[model samples]
Target: MSTYSNDVFLVGTLYGQSAVSVSQILSGAGANVSSTALLGAVLNEYNARLNDPAVQNAADWYSSYRLPTHQEIIENYNEVAALSPTEQLAIGKLGKLTSYPVMIDLGPGNVQLFTAIGLLNDYKARYPNSDPLNLKSYENDYSALAADLTDTFSDTTVKFAGLMVQKGTEWGSNNVANWNDLSQAEKNAFAVFFYKVGENEMNARLESAGGNYVPDLAGAPIAQEFYSNIEGIDSAVVNSFGSWWSNALGSEQGFAEAQKLEYYADFFEQNPEAFSTNPMFLNHLISEVGHDGLRQLANVFDWPLCFAEGTLISLGDGTQIPIEDVRIGDVVTSYESTLPLGRLQNKRVTRLFKNEVAHLLDVHGLKVTPGHVTLCGDGQFAGKHVPIIDILLSDGALVRENGDLIRMAINKPVGSREDQFVQVSYAVDADAAREGNLQSGKMRVGTLLFDRDDQPVSVLDCIQAEGMTFNPKTGLVTRAGGSPEPLYFFGELPRPEDYILRRSRETLEGILTDGEWEGTPSQLVGQRLRQTYSLKLH
Candidate 1:
């Protein structure tokens, strides 16, 4: 919605005459008046002048003045009926001037008359001290009157405007004469009147059968003008009107969604690495901007991210290959350090269907393969050759043994030790073997000395083990014939608390290096992640 200022006038003329002259002329315009009591008083004056005979030609002007026809009167009544409740009340207050108690006869079967009477009674009850007989008093108490009318009316705009006027402190009009000279109370009164008129007219158009109540982009200026001219109205009230107007025009939701998209765009500009470390962040980003919006943001920021079925990664040696095309023993440059070129040492694909990388690393020991793992050109892990059994037992990677994949005991604490010795076979797929297409090297594994089951065990536990000999290909434990040997098995591996901390630090560093960010560093990665991924609202 747009904002605007009210136009103020210092002096004004009516019908090419001064205010006093116009008021005097209107006071004597008997034919223009609609009050029955005023008409009767005029007739009484005419009769008195005729009987005196000294007042010659007094009846001449009265004779030429014709009362409005019944049809015209009915039309006028209908016009009043069509007016907003605030306007109707304003006009009703004017009826008191002629000492004529005008009954709002809405014809037969119309309950509007009763409804208006009930509302007026309630209004009088609320403001018992307010004068109902005087027009100036009525004008002064317009806020209360408008509030009552608004409560009694079905029209939402009138209800809204009435609420604003009641809550507002100052009011004025562009059409009022000597606006600056008017007292605060008078100005407020004028503001209430002006609002009633404008609201009535605007509501008429808005409530019409084919009204343009819901504003589009083009209607923003109109909304701005309408809302801005109302002095002292709450900003929230103005926004509510704009929301209603836009909803009526069928643009509110669309505009809001567009605003979210713009917000995400700005977020990406401010925080770049947020998308790299946290993959789930993409879900929220996708929801706000949609696939196309994500694509647009990615392009604008040169984000090395993709959500396709397959991904192609570039090696440090400038070799670009699809992840699916990568095979065991194939050398790839490492992204861990830029100074010295590092080769892919270990490679393993532990398929994760719905698991988060962080959760897997923290709860379960992550397997370190012989080859490095690079994500979006960032080195996630430097390859290091480790036995398959060591990878399964130490790194907590799922192991395939005896035609069954051995799942990690995720519930077990990292430093916890278990005395149970579970036996399993070790099998390697064709892609995972050193040379062959497929290989099966089975071994029997048993726990000799295990860590306690209460706490997480660390690499220190493995270093402290004594008198244990096991085959790397097949986890087979051997003891010298008839020799008494003491062997210990480490229970759950050490929790990757340090690794997690390092990853968090790296994520922040990536964020700082990704964009033109000059802000102070923050440890609030989750907060930054939420801001970066969530929709931006206006």
Candidate 2:
């Protein structure tokens, strides 16, 4: 039988709204089933599940498990699906709560103190005999009962925002005070303004994350990297981020529009270092900005960090070399530094990969990816190398205009991480691989597609290779060659505690007869459906 004939494609189509559905994964083709039947089966199954609120995202690639009774039928192939070491490590470090029922999520739940307080006070006045922070009340309200409630942020939330936002000069200096000097309302103002823009996601991680933090889940480490990049690039630019606030009490408008989440919409378009778009951050932005608003942002969206063929990698120093001419071990100028007599430092590149994007941002003839691998250039975060799409709030690169930071998104056209005009892509980031020091490398153009399978990868040497496929968006898996029906097997992820705790140790102890992790991140979408929507799947 041909690879496409007998090969099985296990398909799961439980994606959220605006998600990829029916991309086609047909696994069942009994001897009696025709090619038309197989096609119809896949389409019929997808249409049946089209409205199933429980549809999962397509990015999950967890290992699989074969039922004991059916294990002997299929031969030669391994008993379970396989996972890469990096993917294994990613699960342990990056995994967190995916589904919630109005419960407090310390991640995006961290709100500005002022907003929290104001909302709390409002809630209290509405219901004098109630607890303002009650989770049950919120759950009821979510179900359309009566009590209105919301999540809580660690009081420590927004303190970092205060510190990061500073009045660079007399321009906003008289009005804005250093974090310590800021009054109560001013502190709330900072938090209010920050949250108004959108979830910076990084605030919680960088604020409470202790010293032992490592490379974490998608978009987690972005805040630290963004802060580092702006600080390294120029102190004055850092000031521009907050110069607009000017002691003004924050409202829906009039905050530091400089680092606004609007600009990073472009960064989201590229999906940064993510294999596909970061689902968690993507969902959050959609909730706040809406699809049309995000679609309308033309700013930094035009500038993909990916450079075109034959572009030279610019060093912090004056020298420039053809990017392809640079090798893995070579050192390049990354970013600016003020210590040791104020000079730029050279750093080594550790990991390199091919990446792709639909469009490239040309800022004054300097082409690059927008917000991709910003982590590498800005080493304030944990990781070998990566760009934090939800940095602190989709970390941005701004230019000073009228002494205020202009959102880097200006004058950009919208694009997609899914587009494929050119493929010779390679990602260059400021990385700290093997190098203990921070600010390790520079952001250079490169390639990584948000595709599940070998979706047309272009090599720098102008070669193309067939590669395995998995979509990060929906945890969808497919193959042209594999055992037929009843032959498909998958490792089901255990409960949160089990996989996160015991499985990690078991993998280290060689107890993983099957695999280290079992479930896909996309499974959480179903979990979310069960809890929030009162929906039933099985």
- Candidate achieving the largest lDDT: 1
Model 1, 262-322: lDDT tens digits are 6556655754433432233444455555666766666676653212224454544566676
Q: Per-residue lDDT tens digits of candidate 2, residues 284-385? A: 344444544433442334312245556687554567787757665677765343432123467775423344543333433444442343322211222212
CA lDDT for candidate 1: 0.31
Write down the lDDT of every candidate, Cα atoms only.
0.31, 0.27
Q: What is the C-alpha RMSD of each candidate to the true structure, in Å?
A: 31.3, 28.3
Q: Give the lDDT of residue 402 in candidate 1.
A: 18
